[model samples]
Target: MMYQEYVDAITPDQEAGLKRTNGRMLANTILQNPDCFSTSDRASAQTILDSINSGVQQDAVDQLHDDIEECVEDATDEYSWSNC
Candidate 1:
């Protein structure tokens, strides 16, 4: 199959490199032509680049924070110290 041959051609590392390159190119396009995307899309794209530069994706960080908060809340609720 054409798809199978295509898939077999590139190694995992090569695929990852290609994906990163494509993402950078897309980000550059978004920055150079803001009109192509909606306001939220533009903001999201910039946030992605910011997260990449900072060494982690913003969404993953936010989700981690949220998960931690929920865990803390649950633990506190499980050991309530009620006073009269």
Candidate 2:
């Protein structure tokens, strides 16, 4: 089975699983079928996996920034009490 064929064969459930793992599952899948995937195919998969990891990392960083901003705003509001 070619790499593209493997990708095309993924079911909706498998796709959801892939998304949930940030594409990490693809490494196992490719490893299990080493005889089927060529060097270029493996390289392509690695590229895709790297891209997924990069996106996930960016999302985490963005969320952290948003959380910190919210915390700072709350702290500022608390300290700005007119009674003080």
Candidate 3:
């Protein structure tokens, strides 16, 4: 479901016993979800999101991944995660 994407993404596996959504997963989500970002933002966002997903070969991308992960982890709840 549309909602499950976020729920799965936000909950850290550290506590939920679920797989924490890593950069790769987040990248996949970005690639797969058309509505997650604005049309103007999607192209650039996907590039960075995908870059981080790939084991963060680039330090900048890695930092970006960390930032995004932190933001999501801090901001999300079940309902929001549910509808990512």
Candidate 4:
């Protein structure tokens, strides 16, 4: 999402961290609704990503990364790997 866009313009290490965080969020969302990941019912997921990409600002990429980390933490109760 926003985190992914921000991650895209960062260094490899940071990018890897962001990817991991994104994967965690995606996994959790999928866990809540598997169809969102493996079926044709991914409209909501796409919309979230679209919003993130469209509204994300270069100055906010770092903040977006932190936001994703928070999201992952809220989803999994763990912020270690989620803090991209």
Computed on alpha carbons, the lDDT of every model, listed in order, comes to 0.62, 0.70, 0.56, 0.56
Q: List the lowest-lDDT window of 10 residues for candidate 1.
A: 1-10
RMSD of model 4 against the true structure: 17.2
lDDT value for candidate 2?
0.70
For 1-84, candidate 2 gives per-residue lDDT tens digits of 444555566567665445636355665567567787788867877876787778878889999999999999999999897577
Show the lowest summed lDDT stretch of 10 residues, model 2: 15-24
Say which prediction, candidate 1 or candidate 4, comes out ahead on lDDT: 1
lDDT of 1 at 32: 67
Model 3: worst 10 consecutive residues (lDDT sum): 15-24
Best by TM-score: 2
Q: Rank the candidates by TM-score, best first.
A: 2, 1, 3, 4
In the predicted model 3, the residue pairs found to clash are 3-82, 3-83, 7-81
Clash count in backbone of candidate 3:
3
Q: Top lDDT: which candidate number?
A: 2
* TM-scores for every candidate against the unseen true structure: 0.41, 0.65, 0.29, 0.26
- Total backbone collisions for each predicted model: 0, 0, 3, 0
RMSD of each: 10.5, 4.2, 18.5, 17.2
Question: Judged by TM-score relative to the true structure, which candidate is superior, 2 or 4?
Answer: 2
